[model samples]
Target: MAETAAQFPEVQGGGSLIVAWQVKGKTVLVVGGGEVAAGRILHCLNADALVTVVSPAARLNPEVAYRVAQGQVAHVDRNFEPSDLDGADMVLVAVDDPAASTAIWQLCKARRIPANIADVPPECDFYFGSVHRDGPLQIMVSTNGKGPRLASMIRKFIAKQLPSDAGRAIETVGQLRVRLRQIAPRPEEGPKRMAWMSKVSEAYPWDEMCGLSEEDIGNLLRFYPSGKVPALDELKAMRANPGADKEAFDGSFGFSVGA
Candidate 1:
């Protein structure tokens, strides 16, 4: 008999899977008004979620009150009710009463909704990791709710190691991708377009990529047909003299990947 292939369990490791959930324009119900709840509210706002806070007016802390006053978030000046979960896409529980929080979590689970009970790993469907944000770039460090402070420290260290222009590079590359799609609109051209873009990304340094202007992007598009990665100096020359003859670029310029 032939040896059987090894079978594996669904969860080989015991940790929460980190994901960037797009909550934009979705309803997020936050059931509390303390500091923890304030933090949760801010996170929801940052993702452009439609947020509603359910807590008594007297319970709201300064941060939450300020947001409510500014019309940044809708507020229900009362204790959380079952109806609060009616149209909530997601729920966050940060009440002082652990029992209340757990009950809310159970209610969400019964309704097939995701919920995060602050500091309760078992009840939480998701944990907010320490995130470092730079323009369009986001770096998150998580420790499965084991060591949040340590995760924050690690996030800071990682952020420090990255180039200051890293975010700008990502933004520039994103725009380049849009341009590339326009130049090669056919579905069959995807593989070749991806290969060319990959080559261009690997060839240029972050700062140089960030410096790329409209003319530089046009120069890059010219080489997309041949799938050639252009030399850095040629791009620099084009920027230096924008009025220079385009026909002069023979597409024979020597290319070198930046160190």
Candidate 2:
């Protein structure tokens, strides 16, 4: 029988390019100090971006004021100014005055800078999505500015379905990868290293992988040169008896013979 080809429906619109942007050490300018602006500032700070808010000191909400007071963000203590865009890699406008916000957006467009204007979808170069963050994992849901509340609801729903240790499992895998790199330090060994890592990942289930410790990784590294994947029982035994002789185990790494 001939295989059937898969068909997919055409998308209605070209959605925004979803990406994990690395904004560490980049300049992000925020043109407001109200509640909305406060949220933007927090998000920028979380990304390790250098954030500066251009709003009058009196206009700053309590949250914004607290951040400014703690020296977490720089405050311009005045309304938006054209010069404020200098050295800014990204801009976020959240001022209450629609006219001023529009002017700021225009300046950003003229300078070819990326900007997000609050409550003005047409003028925005980007839109903020509702984000759910774990240690090193982040899930974002966006509605393309059509229905933000619905997007947020969806985000919450997704978060509840994820395992609590999902982030820790990712972190454990990262540690194993780093150890593997140290073992295979030559560029020519990349393919073999990747193959071994893939085998190890497949051999262990999520819960087992999450429970792996630094000692377990060391034991796994022993089989790297031979490209052998250790069974779960072999791993447990190795943990139980750190000084056990490897030669005592069968070549199948604790797996029984074909029976």
Candidate 3:
């Protein structure tokens, strides 16, 4: 017997837990070759996931074709087979035929596979949100499959507001973390280290850190104690003169003045 919607009291409204999946080097099966499928395939490729597209008369867009020629994507020019989900980590169905999509969804459910049917939220195990990627940062905005267009607009707005030097800053902070561990190896300093890194991430000078050597970094860390962050005034001054000589003052500032 099929259970009615009222029987499931836990899920009365539309809400999905947004999460970032680590799909790198994992196989993702896309069960269509239309524009929607192509878009999903491109997203998977960007995440470094292995992608396979299945469609009987799959129509490839220009971008999809380029990737295909580059050997980044594998295309099985045939109808979707249940066996296709043999080793798939996730599945995306974008076929135009509603009946075919339903069938695929049912099979995926039986197999306990994560699946997303284009424009069909109720049948989806996950929703593909609008994604914006910086160098090492990725931001995703989801409307719970309600307003995709709105989600895309929000993504554009956020991308424009984000700093272009974010990726560089991330790398600098990464190096700083390694050096900090050397300075403060005690387990007690772990929380302090994280707090200090949080401050650095918020107000970092991406440009100044470009030419700094490892030794130069060590000089800056002397002022920051293992369990304390730099004073606000000191941070402010460094933010005011980002291009000043690093050796001019005590090695207490490496952040940007206008970050």
Q: Tell me each candidate's TM-score.
A: 0.83, 0.85, 0.74
Q: Give the C-alpha lDDT of model 1.
A: 0.84
Task: Tell me each candidate's RMSD, in Å, in order.
Answer: 6.2, 7.1, 8.0
Tens digits of per-residue lDDT, candidate 1, 103-189, equal 999999999999999988889888898888888888989987788999999998878776655687788899899998998999998
- Backbone clashes for every candidate come to 0, 0, 2
> Between prediction 2 and prediction 3, which has the larger TM-score?
2
Model 2 pairs in collision: none
Please write out the lDDT profile of model 2 over residues 1-259, one tens digit for every residue: 1233235554667689888777799999999999999989988998899999999999999999999999999989998889999999999999888998889999999999899999988988778999988888888899887889999999988777665555776888899889989978999999998898889889976645655668788888888888998897787677766445443233341221211
Q: Candidates' lDDT values, in order?
A: 0.84, 0.83, 0.75
Which regions of candidate 1 fall more than 4 Å away from where they truly are? Answer: 1-12, 205-208, 241-259
Candidate 2: residue 226 Cα off by (Å)? 2.0
State the lDDT at 240 in candidate 2: 61
Candidate 2 global TM-score? 0.85
Candidate 3 collision pairs: 205-256, 239-257
Weakest lDDT window of 10 consecutive positions for candidate 2: 250-259
Worst 10 residues of 1 by lDDT: 250-259
